[model samples]
Target: MQIYDVCIIGAGPVGLSLAAALQKSKQLNKVLILDSIKKPKFNKQGLPNQRVLSVTQSSREVLQSVGAWDKLEQGRVNPYNRMIIDESNGQDYLEFKNQQAHIIEYDNIVNALLEVYDGEIEFESKLEKIELKPNEYVTVNDKFQCKLLIGSDGNKSKVKECSNIGTYGHSYHQMGIVCTVERTDQDSEVAYQTYLSNGCPLALLPLYNPYSSIVWTAYMDDYKYLMSLSDEEFLKVLNSQLGRYAPRIKSISNKRMAFPLQSLQAQRYIQKRIALIGDAAHSNHPMAGQGMNMGINDAALLANCIIKNSRSGNDIGLEQSLEEYESQAKLMNYTTSIAMELIKNTYENKTISPLRQLGAKIINNLDPIKQIMIQYGSKHPLGPSQFEWVK
Candidate 1:
């Protein structure tokens, strides 16, 4: 019997972020956030979570505005001033010298959002069912009512499923292996990745001092072989594979986790009074570290749309209002998703890899092109108008 202006399902960083942003913007008076999982706990003793996020400048701005950035422990945030991507052959290298990104523990972002969030969150509240009446409010499990429903749940979202929203995407036949690792040299603030002949790109992303998070994307067989090794043997293989990429891994902490890679997008981002964001709306390969970034953008854009709609005295959940959000967000997500897919395909195709490498070399030498790419990767370096909303 409790009616809220907005109810967001899934309390992950993206979902919680939306709740916080809405409250901060004063766009909605009452918002409800529900998640199946309990609140994420910060690891006090062991290694940080294997999951890491590359916070772009724009995303950092969003977090800063909501007070989440300040909530993040300063020691755990690693700011990478440079990034380099190249082939194992040392050809086709691209480097960005500016402060390209920051690596933050996943839980840090969530806790930060939680710190600033003043709205209601129902932990362990799994969404059992969702009822949707076109052009009307949505009902959740016959208990909660909301003028608008937002699904920030992951790829297999209950809200998206209950709304009968179709999706499109394909698996990359790859698995991403993630683990925390230590390197001998920690002075460098650069993140590095090398594309291997096997079509997998192994990246070393810096964490707090001396520690880094490894995201090695590999084919199924390669992944299986890597997983079969002991910790010591795995470290050796990693070092040997890197060849000349110095500062080898001294040791790896925590167990490695592997996830299937895919690019998925909902056929439509909105359905009547219900809308989807984050992984619920689109899930992309992690090669670019843009999955969560895209989700963050979704939350921001949706908040802006709702604010505009409410100010205009129009129903916030109406298709017209939601369309304004979907049009821009869907296009941006699609463009980035397709670009990533093409890069993956180009690298995976061994026959054309040489040409691809040549092309990369060409682009690397072109200052204007490289600068543009770097700027775009940093989330619209040209200006805030292109991508950023909500100031």
Candidate 2:
């Protein structure tokens, strides 16, 4: 019969970050986080984790607000100042020169958030049941009750399922192959993404010196064939495919991993005393590397809403108070999702190859247009930013 002001499900980066943000407010004392799995450990001495996030400037600011940015191991954070985009035909290309994004290990981000968040965490506490008590509160597993129950548990969230929130989106029917590779020339801090003839994009994201991470998006059949190749054979194919676009690969530094790609968005972000964030609410194709960044924004905006409501002596879980969060977050997530889908479809269309190449050249030469696109890709907040609440 323990009651908390907020109970967040899932202990990934997004969940922990929400916990950290809530813990920053003195008015909200009873906050808890529950995760079904044990705490993840980040080995600083080991090879970089296959899973990495491209932290944009906006995401960096959110982490800084919660005091987690400084906790990240600086040595492992690789900031790429430039990004090169082109087609396999090499007819035209686009180059963006400025601080674009940072490639950091997923475990590194989780560990940093854990360090900054000093709230109650229940590990191995799988959610079995959730009972809604109308305007009163929501109870989980008949053990913990909270005025607001936030779901940060990822795409297959139990909280989302129990709340009966329906999601709508289509699968890309593609897989993203991720792995760490050694590069002969690592002095350059640049990210290269080239769309192949088959419309798949292979991105080489710079990591720590001498190493980089690759995210190769391919159709299901091509993915299966690539995964079947030996390490040496795969490297050969990769080098031959990149040609003059990417740095020469010296060796495969980590085991290759693949995951299905899809774009998902919950029907609604809030229901009564329940709310959803992160992958629980929406997930997008990784082509833009904005999935994690979008989730981080969700946690930030939700935490800000909850904090402001609490300070104003308002009910945190009430629909009115949570509505703004839902509206804003959904708008951002939806816009990004649509943009990614359009990019994916446009690149895969063979008839638009000439126009696409011409457009890339035109945009590359237009500084203002290119900057605007970069900001959009970074998910920079616009007009009366919600981040003000964090400060």
Which model scores highest in TM-score?
A: 2
- Structure candidate 1, residue pairs in collision: none
lDDT of each: 0.83, 0.87
For candidate 2, lDDT tens digit of each residue in 1-391? 9999999999998888888888876669799899999888999999888998889888888888889999999899999889988888757898888856899999999999999988899889998889998879899999999999999999899999999999998788999999998898956489988899988899988899888889999899999999999999999988887736678899988789999988899999998888899899998889889888888888888887888899899999899999988998888888888888899888899998999988998988999988888888775554126554455
Give stretches of model 2 more than 4 Å off: 383-391
How many residue pairs clash (N, CA or C atoms closer than 3 angstroms) in each of the candidate models, in the order given? 0, 0
TM-score of each: 0.95, 0.97
Q: Please provide, for model 1 over 79-140, each residue's C-alpha lDDT reduced to its tens digit, 9 standing for 90 to 100.
A: 99887787776455777778568999898889889888978999899999988866667889
Name the lDDT of candidate 1: 0.83
**After TM-score superposition, what is the CA distance of residue 187 in candidate 2 from its true location, in Å?**
2.7
What TM-score number comes out for model 2? 0.97
Clashing pairs in 2: none
Query: How many clashes would you count in candidate 2?
Result: 0
Instruction: Determine which window of 10 residues in candidate 2 has minimal summed lDDT.
Output: 380-389
lDDT of 2: 0.87
